[model samples]
Target: MVNKLVFLILSTVILVGNQSFAQKKITLKEAFKDKFLIGVAVNRSQINQSNQEETKLITSQFNALTAENDMKWMYIHPKEDTFNFEQADKLVELAKANDMFVVGHTLVWHSQLAPWVFKTDKGDTINNAELTSRLKKHISTIVEKYKGKIDAWDVVNEALAEDGSYRKSPFYTIGGESFIENAFRFAHTADPEAELYYNDYNLINAEKRDGAIRIINNLKSKNIKIDGVGIQAHWSLEEPTIEEIETAIKMYSETGVKVMFTELDISVLPSPWNSPTADVSVSFENNPTMNPYPNGLPDSVQTQLAKRYAAIFELFNKHADKIGRVTFWGLHDGLSWKNNFPIRGRTDYTLLFDRAMEPKKAFNAVIDTVND
Candidate 1:
């Protein structure tokens, strides 16, 4: 009887240990496999597979990959006649190897665009014809190169202002609204099979949401192949209420295209403006108060972050049919762009994984939203 009791205790201990181990194996991609594609924007280090730990985390946890900066115009097509395919090729190759869905970050954007694209050799802004030729060539070359490998392309990014008007970017100035229309057309011609999307930030605002819808309507009117709209979800702890997000998702889907939370990262820091903005050009002088959690996020704030992520995921799950994909901007907190955006050199804990690459409370909270 004594031996049997001891055996029973050991069996219970082993069973509980196995259960814990099994629980840990549930990855983000697996948890949301039926909902949407789990994705992360990967940088050069990860694309090159230099950091084995991060690469492993990426392949195991996420099923979709977006090249953070490598595929952007400045990096991919820096000159009128020159095209750089080194890094972009590696990123596509890595994604293919992992059986991951690849996103070509952007084909046209005002920011990070090469000056040569709009200027003549003599330093004058090129004519509309020249600009159109350059835009077509740039989009065609890149899109056709990875036609089938790249699952989607952010055809035009941040082309509208916060108030719902077209941003007077050089693209708009030179080519008018036809610039956006032409971009989608050019990409579609290059790879009719690949999905093309218009990506923007601050889309939760009512006016901006209407602006995105207008773009979708215009594209569909012309029979352009615009597959989705990417709302950059660079949100904060308590702004752009959950209702606003759900409404935006529903509205975008109603336009006959899918919705995507393309670049998601919930910042725990204070906003510099009245509302959340992912305008990379915006910056503020760093102050101690703004960088409140320099040492590390306190437990209270961490709990808040967890709950915030949970609420957001719950909404995503609620409308999973509308959302085609949800991608985090980076893999871990240490690599998050929030650390330098708006205020440079500020330590901000803004990702599901902490600096050590360990899954934080927010990560577990996101998983529980589905599992529970």
Candidate 2:
């Protein structure tokens, strides 16, 4: 009798455990429902799985995908004389198989560019004319190659500094400020159907916000096909209130172009470039440890980070009609570029999923925040 009772109790617990587990795990399909879309930036390793396990998981959830590396000049043309498309080819294939839209990361940017493009045989800088020809050729080839495959193109990225001045990007030195116009023109010629966008960071500020408006409006006046503006909301634990971001979005929409929140992530750490001694703890309200957990991101800081992301999505949902898409920079915190830049060699938790592929609170918050 005792043995039977014990066995019965254990069986009951097993069934209850299974039911609880099912409730906690939400698939991408269920999470995404029918509201605003959610997407992730993908690297080669994720798509190259032999069983295509990782690729399927992501594609099933996201209707869109962005190439994290291949579109960059470094990977496309590592050597001046050669062009490589092996990785890019694989990515496009995966997107096709999964019936997902692809976003070509960039046509021109300051970072991750090939050294050979800017330097000559004698080590002197190349002139604007030569650079212009190369820029046109590069844009034409890539845009033409993936003409219909990519849904949209970030023609020029982060072209303005925070203060609203034209950022001193390498493109400026090589093709003059007019490089922006030339890039969009060439991309349009190569693939008129694909949407062209002027992507940048810190547009939340009024100064940068106004400057972006002027540029896009000017392009519209000249009949240059600028389809949208990409606001890279790489916010910190503090700063960039919901109203500020919403205003920026509304400002861009006035130019008759779509607004997208691309490259979204919130880093909870010492701001202003990670001075280890800085008092970042003051930024958070709930959890105020000066030096928190892993990578010095305090638990209190994580709570504040979660709230911040939730607020942004609330704004996104409010403006879903005007907002084109919302994209997270990476699949997991382990793969985020934040771990390296602005504050080199620091472990930063700025992604939705933790290093172990487990969904963080931010992930759930976003799902709950989004309505089907």
Among the numbered candidates, top lDDT falls to 1
The alpha-carbon lDDT assigned to residue 310 of candidate 2 equals 79
lDDT of 1 by residue, 130-199 (tens): 8889889999999999988899999999999999999999999889999999999999999999999999
Winning candidate number (TM-score): 1
Q: What TM-score would you give candidate 2 relative to the actual structure? A: 0.84
Model 2 lDDT tens row, 56-89: 6577567678887777889887787788888778
Instruction: Show model 2 residue runs off by greater than 4 Å.
Output: 1-35, 50-53, 273-291, 295-302
RMSD of each: 2.7, 6.9
Assess the local accuracy of residue 39 in candidate 1 as a C-alpha lDDT between 0 and 100: 98
